[model samples]
Target chain A: MTTPLYKKTAREIRDAVRSGAVTATAVTEAHLARIAEVDPKVDAFTQIWTDEALAQAAAVDAKVKQGVDPGPMAGVPVGVKELICTRTGKTTCASKILENFRSPYDATIIKKLDAAGAIFLGKVNMDEFAMGSSTERSTLKTTKNPWNLKCVPGGSSGGSAAAISADECAMAIGSDTGGSIRQPAALCGCVGIKPTYGRVSRYGLVAFASSLDQIGPLTKNVEDAALSLNTLCGRDPLDATSADLPVPDFTKALTGDVKGLRVGLPKEYFTEALNAEMREKVEAAVDVFRRGGAEIVPVSLPHTDYAIATYYIICTAEASANLARFDGVRYGYRHPGAKTVEEMYVLSKSEAFGPEVRRRIMLGTYVLSSGYYDAYYLKAQKVRRLIKKDFDDAFEQCDFVMGPTSPIPSFEFGAKTENPLEMYLADIYTISVNLATLPGISIPCGLTASGLPAGLQMIGRPFGEETLLRAAHCYEQTSGITLGEPPIA
Target chain B: MSKITKQDVEYVAGLAQLRLDDAAKERLVREMGDILAYMDQLNELDTSNVEPMMHAMEMTNVFRQDVVEPSLPREEALMNAPVHDGEYFIVPRILEGDAS
Candidate 1:
């Protein structure tokens, strides 16, 4: 019996391919077989393209035989979040509205990954239009945590995180708009990074909140996260928002050095509201940094308390405008027997969108409406500036800011579903980073007393991914925390 | 200061074109009220002279050239629709002047 290829990290699989010990076809086949075996129980994938993945892996093997060096992600299997466009497969955004949608062309990142010889495993599930924090809001199917099948993986990118953690794929790409990627990564016990807003191209990424959305990598460890980011980052002409900056060698920066580094622990982040177990795990991670000759200082982000409210308003307002394109006439689901175009628009959106998505769209529409725009959307934008200023000031005093990614570990599937306010509050610590347009990462720090993984989040200055990765890499090395595998039957 | 009402929720849902059930409306009313109450903190911060910001970093006129590019064909664009006429979308009559 062969060990599952999905159980290994991208780097491990890449090493096997490089050494010729295992062919790319073998690794791809194993992952495809594993998805077939496990995805039904977990509901992680929205679309599985096994035949296409096998074909792609065979082409990669052919190139390797001809002495061609496929780039960093060579022969590794990865899952694309359903929101991103893939030429060969369907891209639904996990919404009933776009349930049957297929892109004629690939997203910029997809094209790049294909060129690097990475095989596409399939499209993973997500919240409808990436609105809600939990995959429960998906119009298609719910994505469950691999750790506890009843618990959510923490979403909109819940499926991607669960897929990676459950050994469904070697790695997965997810988007972060108000912590969609990191929150789920934390909950699922995987390594996920939300690159600085413009660091990665968002051209073909279905816009959630343009300013807040960034495509990032979800992997089993810090090193794989680095490798995935290497292929995904850089400027693209297709996306005007993509920064015209040089892509750094993220792997080269992971030398695991935190000596003489100043790490800031935001006092506001550790509050009475935070779960005691979560705080303890995060603090313990900070101790590892302290032991590595790093100084931990008490810092304050005074504006942090208002982050959730500001993030919700701004993100929803932007989403309402962005989603206006799906009016049933141009694209997506349409009402079968509507009398007029307006009725068609109404019926399509109402039927296609899940509850949380509709809630956001409503809130967004209200905020962006003529009379309310100044009081709500404009005010939120101003508050957003102050929030960013707080980070700018904090970064001057310390190299990175550390905190708990979520107030609690993975919760039951419908725990907060009834109360939308509670769900919004779950993203408290994470939304500020998006508002600030800073780089942030979530790495597994320790397991809670309940044995579920807890993540310690680190925030760095704008375009300061190198500093943040170095700090995380240092902790990852010294902490001696081995990756946990899901008990997939 | 954050005085939200059921009417406000209804009005917003209408603007969003959402068909909310009684339970959803009640739930949204409560949640939106709580959210608005939390947002009252903004009123405390004096903004007499402070300028409202639209983006975090100072970026201005971030646009691309209005270049003509290839677009998806009509058939491809209509691929995701649930129901479509030959060249246009088909829907129930929402306004008058239609065969009911």
Candidate 2:
């Protein structure tokens, strides 16, 4: 039997749409229909943009009819995490404060993808302000792992990753601040990329941690991620921090060549912290590289153990400052009974933010508070320098640092939520990439004995996404993980 | 590492403008204590001579040309405001006034 149109990769769908094998409308409809069928079981979407997506797809079909080039991401159904600003619908960040807040303008990537002919299937759930390691922190709804409804689809991009895993969308755009993109991608068995820190624009991404936050795509495989990079990369005048480098055709880098490439295995990532099965899966990935004619080098990142602690301090500090914009006077939820300005600010914020959000804010405030700034915040910034230096030193010896994305695969809901610090530990392998401003990709490598997916994370040098994509493409082809459907309906 | 106290949580809450009731404050005191204790690990690293890195990729003073660019219109900008007065965001009385 032929694969469903919804199950086709974005590249295949784009080619078929261009060649007239299928209409963009049909592709969009199939995905929408699939979402209707499976998203309820996965709870992936917070709001499905049925009408807007159809309109976008219809325009793609119209372009094909008129012989107009429909741009690179043609006819792809894309799910956007709710934190990204989209003028068509509310950009809630899965929080009560902005639950109904409509953005006046679309984010830079949103505008770019719309121009590229990708349909916005809808806004999906995420941790409130993209702050948590699990979707449990999302105030909208909990997004579950597609492989097992009982387990969490790792977050704060859980909705984006789960939607792709469940065949609800052709691709998804997610933000990574302390592994929000890669960790979830790892758990859900999707290929998620967090490009070099300033490689993509963050103009309309509601800032979680300004220095750490970056936007990238979560797709079913590496090729589509390459295509997404082709469309999404380059300097954005809207975002000051966005790099001015020339955007390369990332697809060309996926030549599946790994001979003579040096892959660094950071000894710290494979230590006792990693589960035995996860370690075995990652070690198998090392063998895949060895067999592919790539040299496996052992590198030490001595500061690796400090990543989780350092990331939490820096991110929360930034989040505390970034989230200060949600005052009652501006857009978003506001309590009506305040007779004084001070009362309004306090009451509105207290009522709007969730528990995790509140905890982070308080922590952030404490770190930046006058007496403690140098001790907590400044010390973390220095420690962050050490973390980045470790990567720099490692990259000097190898092309990519290879390891497991998360310490383990997806876990049952509420397993780590009780202890915020425990949840933070899940992202240990991914946090340093953000801290160092390097590109990283998490592609499915193997599944656990019980049938959950494990991801092999590859960290590339600064602005070295080309090599990383090539390596990911190469590893994915040879690695024995079979791309199979989840047990869900 | 210092112990995180209820007073500290309350003080930080005031600074962050999040009004926390007693239950919330109690919860934060414990949670923040555990988290802050974990952060003490950073104290182990002797960063005496290290410069603090604020951003991962450093680009300083990115200035755009001084050209006029259209921004979101007042109406569209105010569309999502909870208490907008058409031309402005209406807020609670800033000055201390008589008790209601």
Candidate 3:
């Protein structure tokens, strides 16, 4: 009953590859074969870089043969969410605008992964411009939840999360602006981390909301998340927002000792909005920490009600400004036969962007408009400060805050498509972390009654990922709930 | 709560440089109204004295060495352009009567 090569964590695969138990090419082949077998039903990947992956894996194998250290993540096959730029492949962000677009540069994380000897399996699908809560907003294709093919993989990192759950790759990279990374990972039964805002560089990650977005890893376990975070972190000169701080090896945090750790349970998060079954499971999962000698205290984030409103206003405002760079002038999709420059800009964006993107853009443009700035945009920013202070106040009494990642488990495709606000509410628990600029991790605690996965979210202070990973690892060790295999095979 | 009308959608769409047809415009009007109504709850919180927090990190004046670095070459930069001349990006005429 050993785990399959494709199902093993990145650390396991990397160790096996470096130890000569398996060749890097063999590891890549296992994942490529798994993707070929499972990805058709899941539709997690937008492109599969067979040749490039094979070549990179072969290079790692060569380094190993020469008795040289092939790096920490040698031969680990990884999925890059399409929103993160990869120089060789298309970085479409699952939108028609960048459908044929190839990035001229690699994102800082991509470069770091390559240097660490991880093989790029190709670009995974995402929401169009990473704007929606569900992958249904992707103009490229709808990525299905591997747990239940009919349900939507919670998104805009749906494809990345699905890729890991479907065992198409050892691990994947995803960006969380709000809950894109953690929500999908929670739904797909994997570990997702949204590091403290500046912990990972955002150099070439396509900005959905500049202030909220952070690049993180989706993995089979917390150790692999810690391992991947080790490679992805560290400041980059190219990004001014990147934290100029020392990155300790995150794997060392997995001591599996939660003896004196104080975990906070936000009362607002466990309200009636959370599905009863989900709340029960999350509480049961938190009990694991309590039983493991960690103290659980109920804390209040009074501004919890304002998080969705503040996040929507601020994120959309930032998104509108960031996305304005994609006009017909420089690159990406261009509408042909425009009578004027204005016509070209309008037609190109209107035709290429999906409905969610367009709606956000319009909402953003309105909020930042002349008369509405003080009322909406500025007000949201002020509220954002209050929201951050709520977390600051809570952390004074507790070490890490805990809750269910989403109020509801995975929903049917198109269920929330008609109502964008309903979809936005799905991120109720996770959005506040981004607003507060803190690190958060979602680890699969248990399955819902319907057999779908639900995750327990743990929020940490800024650069407090080490403590979060330590606590999550301690729970993963004690909970005795192995990640369920998707019913695809 | 402010109602997002068809005229408001059209006006905002103009500002965002997006062209929406009648069906899309109507959908946006409803969706935007619903979203705005939800967001209007922010008015309930008293944020009068709070200063705006624009970025998560409190970074100020991150300076770098004033030096030239390798950049995307012109050919690679223009590779994805739909309409590009040999040297410059070609665009439709902007002026009403004059060709530049």
TM-score of chain B of each: 0.73, 0.86, 0.88
**Estimated TM-score for each candidate:** 0.94, 0.98, 0.98
**Model 1 - which docking category?**
medium
Candidate 3's residue-wise lDDT over A1-489, tens digit each? 466788788998888988999998988898999999988899999899999999999899999999989999998899999998888888888888988888888998888999999999998988888887778988888899998999998998999999999989988999999988999999999999999999999999998899999999999999999999999999999889999999999999999889999999989998889999998999899878889999989999999999999999999999999999889787888887676788889889989887788888888998999999999999999999999999999999999999999988899987988778878888899999999999999999888878899899999988999999999999999999876688853
Indicate whether candidate 2 or candidate 3 has the larger lDDT: 2
lDDT of 2 by residue, A14-86 (tens): 9999988899999999999999999889999999888988999989999999999998889999999999998
User: Which pairs clash in model 3?
Assistant: none
Could you tell me how far off, in angstroms, the CA of residue A134 lies in candidate 1 after the best superposition? 2.2
- lDDT string for model 3 (B1-100, tens) is 4478899998999899998899988888888898888888988878878999977798799998899998889998888888898689988876678554
TM-score quality measure for candidate 2 = 0.98
After TM-score superposition, what is the CA distance of residue A214 in candidate 2 from its true location, in Å? 0.3
RMSD of 1: 2.4
Order candidates by DockQ, high to low.
2, 3, 1
Query: CAPRI verdict on model 2?
Result: high
Q: Higher TM-score: candidate 1 or 3?
A: 3
Error of 3 at A455 (Å): 0.5
lDDT of each: 0.85, 0.91, 0.90
lDDT of 1 by residue, A348-432 (tens): 7888787777877878888898888888888888888888888988988899999999999998878898888888899998999
